[model samples]
Target: MTMKKLERFALIAMAALGAAACASVPTYVSLDPSLPRAQLTFHKGYEGTGLFSSAVQNYALGADEYCDSAKHAALFKNVSGTESALRVTPDVRTVVWAFTTYLNSTIGAGGVLGRYDDCRNAVIFTPARNRNYDIRQASTNGDAQCSLVITDAATGAAVRNVEVRASPDCIPRTKAARGSNR
Candidate 1:
């Protein structure tokens, strides 16, 4: 091949790699304070079967981080702006780990297992509020996205919603710093 052709090929390949490396997913968080108890819901975007497992894992982690931060913030608000150590429920951790493991599996299918496998909108939690609550998630688009919603237990009304795009590093360093106490 000519030198010019070889150089052009190299450039195209580099551009493709760069684009893949820069890909990031969006996450959402919502909080409701109308009720007396607190509820948090997390949503993770769907990925194609062709995407790497690590990339999917990163997206899930980003969603978890969003929930983590919001959960803490809710407690702080409940306590009149006083911060405390954060602890995640075993069920929440298990759901996240299980989802990530499925993504890493050879049959992950990018969560496209039909109606049951549609992971574009997953209600990460209903949480243990004083009253019985139901939290559900639904995907509006096929693009990658993750979201978390928190609500008040008594009134079952939303308090806040935060949407964050998941980059390679995911959450900001400052959020990580704030979570150090946990």
Candidate 2:
């Protein structure tokens, strides 16, 4: 091989090795297992509010409730806030992933040259919310099943339906009961 080609190959190999060596083991933060509790909190915020009413109507008609303006507004607000918090929380796996992504994007070659290594880590560590499957189950069992309607507070239009679920338990089972039916 030509000297130039050999030099380029060496540089590429060195870069790959450096990245691997520098890459820290991604941490993960389990979602709040109390899905019921989280759903309750989410539901309470939607009650008596017209912001989600239209969205509820859409869901009833087999349409996408996310299209409702009121529901979208509420979702955007809540999700944005939650995402912001996740970015800053210390010792949190989600935060670490976010930080790593940010570094890769801004510090590295815009995260295009290298795959997004932290994407999965961030998702795994993200906190639980009413939108999650487990949280949805809790909401289905909670009062949300009965009071899922929401309306636009300003326009008095049915915006969407907010289903609140129950909180989840994060405790790990003991090894002795790991395989026991009872």
lDDT of 2 by residue, 39-146 (tens): 111121212212111111101010111111111111111112221111112222211111111111112344223222211111122223332211111121112233
lDDT of 2 at 163: 28
Where does the lowest 10-residue lDDT sum fall in candidate 1?
A: 70-79
At residue 7, candidate 2 shows an lDDT of 43
* Candidate 1: RMSD to truth: 16.0
Runs with alpha carbons beyond 4 Å of true place in candidate 1? 1-137, 141-147, 160-182
Q: Write the per-residue lDDT of candidate 1 for residues 1-182, one digit (tens) a residue.
A: 44455444444443443344224322323334443443333323223332212112112322354434322111101112221212233223212211211122122346312111223322233245343332223222233443433344357686333232233222344656667846
TM-scores for every predicted model: 0.23, 0.16
Tell me the deviation in Å of residue 114 in model 1. Answer: 13
lDDT of 1: 0.30
**Looking at model 2, which ten-residue stretch has the lowest summed lDDT?**
54-63
